[model samples]
Structures are given as structure tokens and as C-alpha cells.
Target: MTIAPRDLLRRMFDAAIAAAQPARCVPACLPEPPKGRLVVIGAGKASGAMARAVEDHWPGALSGLVVTRYGYKVPCERIEIMEAAHPVPDAAGLIAAKRIQKLVSDLTADDLVLCLISGGGSALLALPLDGVTLEDKQAVNRALLRSGATISEMNCVRRHLSAVKGGRLAAACAPAKVVTLLLSDVPGDNPMDIASGPTAADPTTCADALAILQRYAITVPRTVLEVLESGRGESVKPGDPRLAGCQTRMIATPQMALDAAAAVARAAGYPVHILSDRIEGEARDVGSVLAGIALQVAGRGQPFTAPCVLLSGGETTVTVRGSGRGGRNVEFLLSLGIALNGQPGIHAIAGDTDGVDGLEEIAGAHLGPDSLSRAWELGVKPKDRLADNDGHGFFETLGDSVVTGPTLTNVNDFRAILIER
Candidate 1:
């Protein structure tokens, strides 16, 4: 059965996402119900789905609030699903964060706090620290997003600036055994970086956040700067007693997603090459690097021969200088397309596993040997769009943009390169 390159690429992406779905991965890791009460609290793009997974399997009386990015909600009868803005915090998220703080407080040792955390929770669970207003957090968040900072660096700043992140949420539920079920989107699967470690201990300090801001030249409000300098925003450390007995389990992660995609490619009779699931650095730079590899395999057959699929998963950043539709996945694909220079027998797809790239609903885009020709026919110049950081527009005009509303799970970005011999 011969398969088209584009079809095979889409199937690989679907396999990766399907491997991380909450219903399939969350149930087995759930702990037995506590003796007192099960307070289900969570925040992230996947928290709503994770909550619903709990509701489906757990027979205990569970109730709590979970905040997810708008349009990422999953229906649940017992747990309340709250919607909030992501990548930036809004007033709705602020109110929800306060309510979550109240809900988890005053719990006894026998009670259990089932915390569902995933990517995007850092912004969705936005509760600015005292003296740092929501506007202040917003300013810093906006700057961080545009500053080309790595996810860990951006999250370090977010952790110190928030009231609920960096273990404060777990601290609020002190005496109640906290169990965090995570779907990791961050590279390395560090629990502390996932959702800024809301229910886990943080080792990063205010000084580290300050350094990240300095490294990226991201200037925040004066008050936020002062708070970081004073070390008042220091997050809960590893030895903090409040986090005692807290258990964290990574139910799904980027590596697992990549493996699933590899399985699909292998079954389709294509030898799979997994470069890495933790690749980072600038998106455009990574794209250039991958293009070199694809070319090598196609021309020289150096590392591997033809008729193979190279798969990878990880979050990549973009230093946005142009005022265009900037998405990391799109930007990466655009750069990849240009670098390949319409090299035949090579096709690729790049998309965020969560189904939203940057602030746009478009997942990502696909690139073929004729991608440049199609764009030129559509009056979309590859270099011009790349200069404007408008990869989304470039792909859209070519009718090659991949759109999957919301996957309800985030294991970060997925990239695949198929080289036909």
C-alpha cells in the first residue's frame, strides 16, 4: 500500500498526540482515594481533560476547580472546568487562581489533593504576587514571549512572579497529601518546570529569574524588578516541609509521543530515526540544522539511507523581531522550506502537539519539494514572509497549514521529515 508523503506525515503526528491523551494515560497512575476527601485541583491546557479522566475512573467523591486555556475545556460532572487566557494572564484567570487557593487551604492530613498539571498552566494559573499586579505579570509575560527565551528561562521568571506557582499551590494544601499527575511539555520533563511546579518544589531562585530577564533583555515593570531584587519572590525550595509527602508522576511526555510516532512510521515500512525529543534553541536555527540532515540523507545517504522518517519532539523558541504571524512551528517550517531549496524526495511537517502555535489556532504547516513553487504562484515570497516572521500567512496562502483545534494535550512540538528513496 503506497502512501502519500503528506498523508504519512499527518498519521505520524496523530499517533504522537494519541499517545498522550489523558483518557489513555491518566487513569492508571491515579492513586487510591484518600480517607478524608479528594480535592481535585489543576491548571494547564490538559488539566480539564485530566480532570475528566479522573471523574471517569475514580469512584470517590471528588470535587475541585481546574483552569485550562480557553477552548481547551473538557466536560466533567464532578470537577469544575474554568477557562482562562494562556501565554498571557487575564482577569478571569486571576479570579480563578484565588478561588483555587481558597479551595485547597484548610485541608487535613488525611485529605488528598489530586493536582493535574501540564504545559500552559504557568499563565492559566495566574495569581500575581502581592505588590505585583496582574498588569505587571502581563507585561513580563509579553516580553518573555517575544524575547526568544527558552521555556525554562521564561518559566523561571514566571515562577518567581506568581503567587500560586513554584510550589505555593501545594503549600496552600499543606497537611493534605498532594499527588501531581503531569503531562510534560517541557524538555527534560522536570516537574519543577511543568506548569511552573504548582504542586512540586522549585529549586530556582529570584536571582535566577532576574538573570534570565537580563540575559534576554526583557524589561519588566519597576515593581516586579524590585521584588526580584529583594528576593521576596523566592519560590519554595526542595527541602520545604510543606511539600513533604507530595508525589509527582509524569503520565505522558515528549519522548513517549515521539516513540509512538516512530511506531507508526515503522509499521508503514519506513525506517524511523529519532534525533532527540529534547531539542531546543531558536526555531529557525533548528530548522536549518534539520534541513542539513534531510539533505544529507537524500544526497549522500550519510547517517542513514533514504525512504526513512526522522522524528523529533520538543519546544522551540522564536525571537520575534518582525510584526507578523509568529508561531514557532510555522517559523521552523518556513525556514526548513527555504533551506531545502525545493530538494525533491523530502517532505516535512511541524506542529505543536497541543494544536495551537503561538497565539494562533493553526497547529502548524507542511512543506514539500514544490512548497516554494506553490507559494510563488500564490504571490507569497518565501524570503519576504520569513523576514516578516509570517510563516502562518505563508502556509495559509499555499493552503498547507495544518489545523487541529485543540488536542487537549501538550507534549510540546512534533516534527517529522520523510525522505523517499
Candidate 2:
């Protein structure tokens, strides 16, 4: 009943994703039906699945619309599921954002608006403010993705530039109670950071968004900059009466996913070490640090003894310097492999829990002691690929890319390192 290292790593990743599935986590967090209407609306990679979960659990009548990434839709009889672009804004997303705004605009105090939110919602709920076009938002999004800006910073800019984000959606349903069930994908699980807090109050402002754009040197349309400078795009501030009745609960999180993976490792007879689930930074640098820890455990047995597994969950960024397919998980794995330098008995897997890393449909990849050697034999230079931010290309060439079409849930990134004596 012994599992190979790769199999064990894959099993651990499966366990992590299973822990955050909307079907399992959505049932318990659902609120009671309101007196008037129960309107279900949301946006994210997981919102379609979450909407289905709500449909299965609720006994009363409910209807609404939700937008998810293309290929992530789930069937629901009452709630309308729409597909849109992710990591970038599109016309379909713009239409859905407008529909969502209209759906809750006239809700009475007795009505309830249940918003299902997760990663990718920020892009899926795109509705640029006045004078800002979808193309403008898309340009800024591309810049942010390539700028290596943290999720919070990128989202802050998105929140300020959008017509429906940053509590504006909740403000639209002022009289109705907003109960937001969040599958958190950001570090610290801040409600305002999840999907740009469409149903929660925002403390960040236009000045803040301007600062982020400047800090990252992200070039945007001049009017977009003017919107921030004129405070025309200022988000709903804290203590806004519009959000007074808004209720937010984080139903799933990165820490929860990491804990589930730890359980799997322990059950498999490996001593489990749970690292910080909030780890965030440049992906390659973080990979090198984790490699150092793995090397320590494998070589000196320091920190933790051999035959142990190290688990961590958190979103990492990649500042794309080269014009190649870039994914944070693969970048991390590539860097880890380079630092390990063919260290024996140390294997690793890194992937996004949502089943896609960066803009690619590939989830992530795995690394072994022979990964470097195999790449060399295949005429692939690992260091050059890493420098070009081409982790996906490198792994695909080695036939090590992990591709899981769509998991319908997102708790952020998962990383597991197996050290055996």
C-alpha cells in the first residue's frame, strides 16, 4: 500500500482541493431565506459551482445570475450561470456585471442578496467606471499581471476603476441584506480583498490605487489616471451605511486547504510540517527558500527529520520579464529544481487549487531529482526558461505539466515537498 512520491504528492493536492469544494463548504454557510426575495448573484471561477450548491441546499424559491470563467460553469435550474473571461476583462463580463447590478438594484429590506465570491471574480465582474473602457481595464490588467504586483495591489487598482466592485454592488442593494459567502484566495482572507469586496466595505481609496499604479509603473489611459486623481472612482468607504447590513463569511481558505493536505501526509505515515499558508512574494524566490528548507531536512535533518512532508498554501506572483508563458506555480517549481540541483530523495509539486496557473489552462507541474537531467536531454535549458518566465514551456517540453481542466473551486496555490531518507 505504499504510494510513489509523485502519487503521494498528487493525492495530497487532491485532498487540498477537495477540502475547498463548493458542494462541501457551501451548505453550512448558507443563510436563512429572507422575507421577500432570495436573489443569488456572484462572480468567480467557483461561483457557478457555488450557485449549484445553493440550489441544492435551499428549500425556498431563489433566482439570479452568476458569472464564472469559461469552462467552469455548473448546471443550475434557477440560478443563471454565465461564462466570461478570467485574468482579463471582456464584453461578456461587462454585460454580466451590468445584469448583476440591475438584479439587486430594487431589492427591498426583506430581500436577501447572497453573493458567492472566489478568485477570478475581480476580472469576471468587470464594469469599468465612467470614461474607462473595457479595453482600458484589460490593458491595466495585463500590466498588473506582468508587473509582479501582489493580488491586493492589483485588486485595489481594479476596485477603484470598476463600476460594480469595491462595495458598489452592495451599495446597489442598499435596503436588502447582503450575505457574502467567500472562498478566500488572498493572504489573510480580508473580505475587502476577495473579489475586490463587491459586497463588503472598502478601506482603500482612489489615491491608494493611483499609488499602486505608480509603484508598479503600470501605464494606463490618461483618463483612467484622472478618474483616480479626481476621486471619481473612490470606492465605498468603511462605515458606509449602504454596507451596514452586509454580512461576510469566509467559507474556504488557503489555510484550510493546507491543513487538509497535512492530514493526508500524516495518514500516509510521513511526519507533516505545515508552513505558513500566507506565504507571498516573487514565486521563484519563494521556491528557492522552500528548496533551502527541503535541502536542510534532506541533508542535515535539521528543522524536521527525514521522511517528512512540508505543506504550504498561498498565491505567489511572477514579474514577467520575458515574452513567454508564465505561471507562478511552475516558476516556483523551476526555481526549486534549480536550487535543489538534483538533490536525491526530494520531490515537489506546486499548483493552483483552481486548476489553472496564470493565464494557462495547465494547473502546474511536478519536480523530481531527475527533472533537470531530463530537461537537459530534451534540449531544454532550465535556467534560460526560468529567466524567460517560461515555466509552462519548460515543463510542457519535459512532459511534466499538470493539467486539470477546471476544479470549480479556488483556495489559491498549493505546494508540497516530500523528503525521504
Candidate 3:
């Protein structure tokens, strides 16, 4: 049976997401039950699912709270699952953050604090420092999101301004051993970068956050700037005594997801090439570069020949210069389609594993050899939409948007390009 390019690409993407589901990855990473209480606390798009996995597997009594995106909650009787905004901080997040901090306070050495962290926790675990208000954090988050800054850079700034992040959460749980199970969604899978390392020590300093703000030309509230300038926002650094008993386990990662997708391609009888699970930069620029590689394979057959699939996973940024709806995955696909210029026998799919791209609930989009022509027929100017930073708008109009709702897992963005002769 011959598999269509689009169907094969979708299957590959689904395989990637399935490999990172909390139920599949969290159970094995659960730490041994503590001598005393087992308290669970977490924040992320997948925290609810992670908490559920723990409840289903834990032998002892466990009770705690976890905050996730508004629509990403999974039912858990023991672990309270709270919903909050993502990609931006909100009052609900602030309240949850405060409650979460309080839950870990005054713990005993025999007790265990299990921290389940994943992508979007930085915003979901929103607790500003003394001088910084919730409003200030929210504003800074907006600025950072629009600044085209890398995830690590944005998270560095976030850690300095938050009271619960940057190892402070772990510090608060001092005396109680902290066991962090991470579903890494950032490039390189640095524990500190995942959810700004709420339960992990931070090596970055206030100066680094300040420099990032200046580099991105992002202006923060006066209180935010004051906190950074006065060094009052310093996060717990590595080697802190409070973090000595903390342990982090990366249960899922982009490389793992990419490998899963590669397996699907191999089983489908197509040779697979995983470019890099850590690709980064502006979405459009990366799309163009990948298109060049696909073109090379399609025309010259130099790099692995034809009838192959190119896979990559990473977080991409968008400058957001236009007024249209934007998603990095859609932006990438739009750019790739424009570069391909309707070239035959080349098809691609790009989507966030968590079922969201940019601020939209839609996962991402798909592109084919006729994508550009179809857009023209629909009176949609691909370049114009790309200029407007409206990849979601462009793809949606062409009926190519990939909507997966909430996959209950996140390992960053997944991209697959299939080339056939």
C-alpha cells in the first residue's frame, strides 16, 4: 500500500506527540515514595496529565496542586488541577503561584515534593518578586513574546523577575527532598530552561536578564527594571545548599520525539534524515533554509537522494511586525511554501506538539506542492500574509491548518518535509 505524502507526514507528527504523552513517560520517572508525606506541585501544559499519571501509579497517599493552560486540564482526584493563561501571565496564575508556594512551605525533611514541569510553566507559575507586581510581570511577558527573543533568553528574564521560579520553588521545599520530572520542550533540554527551572538551580544572573531586555529592546515596567538593576531579583544560583537534595529527570524531549517520527518514516519505507532537534531562529528564516535543503534533495539528489523525509524539532520565534494572527509553525509553513513556489513532489507539516502554535488553539498547518497555487486561487497572497506575520490566517483560509486541540504533551515544534521523485 502506497501512503500519501500528507497522510504519512501527519502520522509522523502524531507519532512524535504520542511518544511524549505524560502517561507513557512519567510513570517510570516517578521517585520512590518518601518516608513521610508525598506532596505534588507543578505548573505547565502537561502538569495535569503528569499529575494524573502519578495518581494512577503512586502507592502512598499523595495530594497537591498543579496549574495548566485553560483547556489542558486532565481530571485528577488527588492532585488539584487548576487552569490559567499561557504565553502571558494572569491574576489566576498569580493566585495559583502563591498557593503553590505556600503548599511547599514548612515541609519536613522526610516529606517528598514532586515537581512536574513542562513548557508554559513560566507563565502558568507566575509569582512576581517583592518589587515586581503581577501587572508588571504580565507587561514584561507581553514585550518579551513580541521581541523575537529566543526561549532561553526570555526565560532568563522571567526567572529573575519571579519569586517562585529559578530554583526558588525548590528552595522553599528545602528540608523536603524535591524530585522534578521534566517534559523538556526547549532546545538542548536544559533543566533550567524548562519552565524557567522552578525546581532547579539557575546559573543566570540579573545582569544576564537585563542584557537580554536591552538586546531585544524590550521595555519593562519601572518596578521590573528597578528589581533587575538593584540585583534584588537574583535567582538561586547553582551550588545553593537548598538545592542539594533536588533531583531532575528529563522524561521526554524534542530529540526523543524526533526519533519517534523517524521510526514512523522508516516503517513506511522512506529513508529519514533528522536535521537537528535543536534548530532555532526566526521561523521564516529557518523555513527558507529548510526549503533550500528540500529543493536540493528534490533536484540534485545530492543530500540523501529523493523519496526521503527530513525531520526537525525546536522552538522558533516570530518578530510579530504585522497585525494578523501569528503562529511560529504556521509562519514556517507559509515561508516554506513561498520558497518552494509550488514545486512538485514536496510536502511538509509543522505543528507544536502541545496542540498550540502562537496564541491559537490550532496546532499548526500543512503545506504541499500546490499550496501556493491554491492560495492564489483563493485570493490569498502568501507573501503578503507572511509579511503581516499571519501564517495562521493564511493557512486557515486555504483549509490547511492542523488542529489537534490539546495533546497533553509538549516537546516543542515538530517539522517534517517529504521529498519524492
TM per model? 0.99, 0.99, 0.99
Model 2 has an lDDT value of 0.93
> In model 3, what lDDT does residue 245 have?
94
Which lDDT tens digits does candidate 2 get at residues 155-198? Answer: 99999999888999999998999999999999989988888888
Using lDDT as the measure, what is the rank order of every candidate, best first?
3, 2, 1
Least lDDT summed over 10 consecutive residues: which range in candidate 2?
214-223
**Local distance difference test values of all predictions, in order:** 0.93, 0.93, 0.94
Candidate 1 TM-score to native = 0.99
Report the lDDT tens digits of candidate 3 across residue range 1-421. 9999999999999999999999999999999988999999999999999999999999989999999999999989999999999989899999999999999998999999999999999999999999788889989999999999999999999999999999999999999999999999999999999999998889899999999999988878899989999999999999999999999999999999999999999999999999999999999999999999999999999787998999999999999999977799999999999999999999999999999999999999899999999889999999999999999999888888999989999999999999997
